[model samples]
Target: MGSSLSTPGASNANDRPAVAATLPPAGCPMHRKLEDATANVSPPPSAETNIDPRNNIPSLSQNPAYGQTIALPLERMRSSIPRTLSDLSTASEHESASTCPMARGGPSRTTEETKDTWVYPSPQQFYNALVRKGWETPVQAIPVMVDIHNWMNEAVWQEVLRWERRYFNPKQSNLALEPEEIPEVSLARFQGRPQDLSPKARFHMLLGRIFPNVYSELPPFDRHDWMVRRDGWGAEEQDKLHRYVIDYYSGADDEDGNPVFHFDVRPAIDDLDSLTARLQEWARIKRETWLGEEQSSITKDAKINN
Candidate 1:
């Protein structure tokens, strides 16, 4: 009996042009269809496509709403680094040193080094020095006394004047009287004082107290007063007094056209006199020394005229 050909390996038994083996039924149709679909579809792109999570984030670089990020490395570095006080100080110092000529190289010399050394003389010392130099004068002396008087109380001066009138007035003679009745006696006695001071003397005395000057060589009696009181000496005497006072304070030329001393009582008495004398002598010497200069000046003028 011929084996049933429709069983296992059935295609081998059908010898009339034996059929080729085929793929399993389950794979044939579905696999070919899948392959055909895949052929029709495009292949995945080959170029790199970087997908960054940061790109998804809202970035200052791309968004117009956000400020643009600084691109300069220096700007980024500046933002990242914290500045210290020392850095600022160094920068300031550099700028300052550069701007200022003195500060450029190093510190400037101290006041002591650059400035001349000066030793100020004491008040007493200065006065002594002036006296040694010879600058004191009569007018200078008087102002000192006046200054002293001014400093004294007004009541004191009034009392002094009262006593002076009482003791020096010559009209009244009675010294013995009750306190209330003694006005005449007091006036007479006050007027009768031994030291009969003239107005000039009083004025000079006032000045002397105000501006004390040891080097001043004032006459024992007030020459100024005597001159003023003289019967015949009116305007001329007054002029002379005025001139003398002015010369004593402001200085002037002597008879020979030589400059005299300038007497300032600001200094102590001793120093003032010396300074005055020195100034006077200096003026005189200068005049004598410069005599030729004046003559030469005249000669030059004459030549020019000729």
Candidate 2:
């Protein structure tokens, strides 16, 4: 029986003589039929396929779904193999995230942005993006404040809508181009107080708004409030601060008919004339800076076009 499997010529005793007689010297039909029948016979089991009766050897003839799943050997292998060094799978366990993270669009290093690496889109790009996101108006009176303490906060999205609406109806806002209404929230979290930013914060906001030329390194100078900080500065800084204070409190009054300039550091900047002079100078410098930048940008652009 063993010899019959290995040798084409070997046959069982009862049919040996008849089989030999039917076989022709040169490839007869009977011989061809015999060869065809045995052509796909599997090789003897080795260590890899050393399956026992307890093991389920998946057969295509017995099972055919999903067009086909893994072959019996591979199925057993997939169940048995360990993936990483930390995997405690012992030739048996298979389930959950341990299979293959990469196969399922797992964390892609190539596509993810790094920490503190978000490059802001340009104003035009930002407006376009907002429009794309279904915002009816994408313009804003000011940059939207987006610092939220937690995921539960729903105010951020509302703020975006408010900002967008203000673009269409600038006059609807209580906040003037010069910031008549001071909101107690920081447009950015870094302003220390989330709301009602310090004088310093207000200054930067104004600066950025007015001078649209250098959006890169150069700070902003909005047409509105051009100053911040009532304290913490030397002669020039303090002088400018005092002048801003005066202008900011220009029209209000108290019960006794005194001015409503009750902010701290008023004592330090009592010189009205010097404060006025410094404020005037600050305004002049700010205007000149914006103009200079605008001119330089126009010239640079012309040169490029030429």
Candidate 3:
């Protein structure tokens, strides 16, 4: 059925020319008057004006340092100069909300989403960089080397004394031999804080307090007793070897290009690898024999000066 409505003019004579010439085609809903269709359409640019999007993009070549802004974290990491005290202080205030960094905070950004790249320390180059930057010796700051030596000596004597007392104590029997009690005494100071101790000292003390007699058989600590092999052939062996180095051979180095401290204190034997294996086996056994361990505030030679 066609529309019964007609234009509001004298067109009822049916002699009016077909409106298709001036109106939208029949059944074409989308067709609009040309004037209305073009009201919002922008006028075409002149021949002199270029409107291509590719041409309109701002030119980056205008910037003198385009694409050269380096990341502060990456910059600091790539350069091994030990961060300064001021840097640490600034870092402490950087983002207190974070507890993400494994090592004491160097710097941090409050985000779990980041592009992280690990910087494997190149010992010689790193130290050299530190020297160039005038980094203070760790002894002045952390006393890692000195305290490690001191802790080892103190540990040996404490264990020896404990064993002596235990051996002669009236407490005797098969059950007593494997008694469920471990002696844990700090030989550092009477009231000295263990947390205030150096890195190496702290490490030893924690392990000592945790496992007293387990490390008693740990042969006398000597700096030169064991040599850490850098690596072995094959990726699997190399990964194992790298992990061993990271575990035992700390990053601290002497000017002679040698490790300052050695935790893998394997005694000199025909085969060091075999000796280390034996020590691990002995440690595992001692660990199994251990019972409840505790920390006591007992010092070796602390005297109150009043």
Ranking, TM-score, top scorer first: 3, 2, 1
Query: What's the best-to-worst order under lDDT?
Result: 3, 2, 1
Pairing residues by index, what is the TM-score of model 3?
0.17
Q: Which structure is stronger by TM-score: 2 or 3?
A: 3
What candidate 3 gets wrong by more than 4 Å, as runs, is 1-139, 142-145, 156-223, 226-262, 271-306
Instruction: Give the TM-score comparing model 2 with the true structure, all chains together.
Output: 0.14
Q: Could you tell me every candidate's TM-score relative to the true structure? A: 0.12, 0.14, 0.17
Q: Model 2 — which ten-residue stretch has the worst lDDT? A: 96-105
* Number of the predicted model whose lDDT against the real structure is largest: 3
**lDDT (C-alpha) at residue 12 in model 1:** 16
Deviation of model 3 at 40, angstroms: 74
Q: Residues 206-256, candidate 1, lDDT per residue (tens digit)? A: 655665552222312111100001112234322221011100111223344
Winner on TM-score between 1 and 3 is 3
Compose the digit string of candidate 2's lDDT tens values, residues 1-306: 011111111112210011111111110000122223221233333456322111122111112112222221112111111111111211222211111000011122333221111112222322222222223321331022111011101222222222222222223432243434322111110011112333433553355466544211221111111112222223344323221211011112333443221111111124664344335434533454456433211111110000
